[model samples]
Target chain A: EDQVTQSPEALRLQEGESSSLNCSYTVSGLRGLFWYRQDPGKGPEFLFTLYSAGEEKEKERLKATLTKKESFLHITAPKPEDSATYLCAVQVGGGKLIFGQGTELSVKP
Target chain B: DTAVSQTPKYLVTQMGNDKSIKCEQNLGHDTMYWYKQDSKKFLKIMFSYNNKELIINETVPNRFSPKSPDKAHLNLHINSLELGDSAVYFCASSQQRQKGEKLFFGSGTQLSVL
Candidate 1:
């Protein structure tokens, strides 16, 4: 069975605080790993896609790194506007995506 | 412009009723998908259509059916809705059915089955 797990279901950080969210997966064959940010009452917004181990991508204040069995989303100097639920998904051999339960992040000002 | 759009941003109804959620994409993508987000905030892929053809269907109940009239549109119809069916449904599209393509998503439709 293919499964994705995200650690630290919820996190609270003061403005400018930096931290990393973890996404670990178990699948037969890894095809891709995706990161998304979802605001309250809205769908997820695409962030980054990592295809192989040691791959990393960055956008603004967010950086995503992927490994053989897990991925990490690191937030740097986060602002209150950056508060959102971060989701991680893994694509297996098939084209479908298996998503992990998101991490709710709160950047208090 | 909104890349992907879904109708009925919020729907609340009784169990046993039937309803449908419509989704359309203006991104000129050939592949579209439907995903359900439970209360636990876990998103699960329910169906995938490529060029109006069903490409992937997960373990969703038969009551949940997806219709894609064209590559730009995909709708989800639910029959005999149950309380467990309450969740947010998201519509998304990608340029193609590639393994690592980025998906553009619409604001989800929140369904409440009482």
Candidate 2:
């Protein structure tokens, strides 16, 4: 069975603090790993996609790195605006995405 | 312009009533999907349509039906709504049903059943 698990269900970080969220996945064949940020009362926004192990992508203060069995979303000196629920999803050979339970990040100013 | 759009951003109704949520994507994608996010924030896929054809249908109940009149539009109609059916429904589209295609999602519709 394909499954995605995100750890640190909730995290509270002071402004300018750096932390990392983890996503561990088990799939039949790894096709893609996606990261999304969802705000309250809004839909999810795409953040990054990593296709292979050792791949990494970055945007501003956010960086995502992938491994064979897991992915990490690293927030560098995050601001209050960076607070949101970060979701991790993995796509297998069938093109369907299996999503994790998301990590709620609260960056206090 | 919105890449993907869903109508009735919020819906409130009583149990056993019927309702529909419409979704349209203007990105010219050939594949569209419906996902439900429960109160626990667990997002799950309900259905997927590729070029107006059903490609993937999860174990969702039969009361929920998805219609894709065209490649750019996918609508969801739920019959006999129940309190347990209340959740946020999101519409998304992808260029194709490929292994790594990025999906564009619309603002979700929050459905509340009394």
Candidate 3:
């Protein structure tokens, strides 16, 4: 069975703090790995998609890096507005995406 | 414009009542999906439709049916809603079956069954 596990279920950070959220998965075959940001009462917003190991993508203060067995989302100098639940999902050999429970991030100003 | 949208942001109904949540995507994508997020924050895929064809159906009960009238619209209909059915449902869309394209999601619909 395909499974995704995210570390540090929740994190509280001071404004301007940099942190990293971990997402490790075991899939039959990884087509792609995805990262999304979801706020309370809202749907997840697409962030990045990494296809191969050693690939990295960045947007604003967020960076996603992928490896053979896991992926990491790094937030640099995050602001209060960046506080939200960060979700990591992986597309198995099939076209369906299996998601992690997510890491709740709170940025205190 | 909203890339993906689900109608009735909140739905509250009694058990045994039937209800429907509608979803549409204006992104011109051919693939659409429905996901359920439990109160504990576990998100799971319930169904997916690609170009109006049923693609992935995850062990969802037959009482819960998904209707895709067109490629742009995929609506979920629940018959005899139960307390266990209460959860936030999200609608998402992606382009072709190709890899590397991210899925765009709607605002979501929160369902409460009492």
Candidate 4:
């Protein structure tokens, strides 16, 4: 069965702290991996899309790196406004995108 | 302007009642999708429409039906709503021809069934 799992269901960090979130997948044919940031009472906002292994993408304070079996979203000196649930999804055959339980990050100022 | 938008931002109803959530995307995308997020914040795809055609339907209950009246509109109707059906339903869109393109999501509709 194709599955995506994210580690650290919840993360609490002080402002300007750094951390990393993990997303591991076990799909037969991996077409793409996407990262999204969702805030409370709002929909998810697209962050980055990693297509193959060793691919990395960055925006502002967040950087996403993908590998053969897992992906990592690294936060460098995050701020309170940067706190949100980060979602990871893997695209499978027929354009089916499977999502993992998101990691809720809370940065306290 | 909103790229993707859904109506009835909040829906509260009793069990066994029927309701519908409407969605529209102005991004000119070829594909639209419905995803459900449970209390645990786990998102799961329910249905997908590509160019107004049903393309992907996950293991969802028959009571949950998706209708695409046109290329830019996809609505989800639930019959005999149950308490377990309470969740945030999100509408999303993407270009099917553009492989690996990021999906644009709308502000989710929060459904609460008592």
lDDT comparison, 3 vs 4, better candidate? 4
Of 2 and 4, the candidate ranking higher by lDDT: 4
- Model 4 misplaced regions, further than 4 Å: none
Candidate 2 docking category?
Answer: medium
Write one digit per residue (lDDT tens) for candidate 3, span A1-109.
8999998899999999999999999998899999999999889998999999999999999999999999999999999999999999999744788999999999999
True contacts kept of 1: 0.82
Return the top candidate by lDDT: 4
Position A73, candidate 3: lDDT = 97
How well does candidate 2 reproduce the true complex, by DockQ? 0.75
DockQ-better candidate, 1 vs 3: 1
Off by over 4 Å in 1: none
TM-score for candidate 4: 0.98
> Mind giving the per-residue lDDT tens digits that candidate 4 earns over A55-82?
9999999999999999999999999999
lDDT of 3 by residue, B1-114 (tens): 888999999999999999999999999999999999998788899998999999899999999999999999999999999999999999999896677668888999999999
Query: Candidates' lDDT values, in order?
Result: 0.94, 0.94, 0.93, 0.94
For B1-114, candidate 4 gives per-residue lDDT tens digits of 999999999999999999999999999999999999999999999999999999899999999999999999999999999999999999999988355877899999999999
Listed per model, the TM-scores of chain A against the true chain A are 0.97, 0.97, 0.97, 0.98
Per-residue lDDT for B1-114 in model 2, tens only? 988999999999999999999999999899999999999789999999999999999999999999999999999999999999999999999999787898888999999999
Question: Which of the CAPRI classes, incorrect, acceptable, medium or high, describes model 4?
Answer: medium
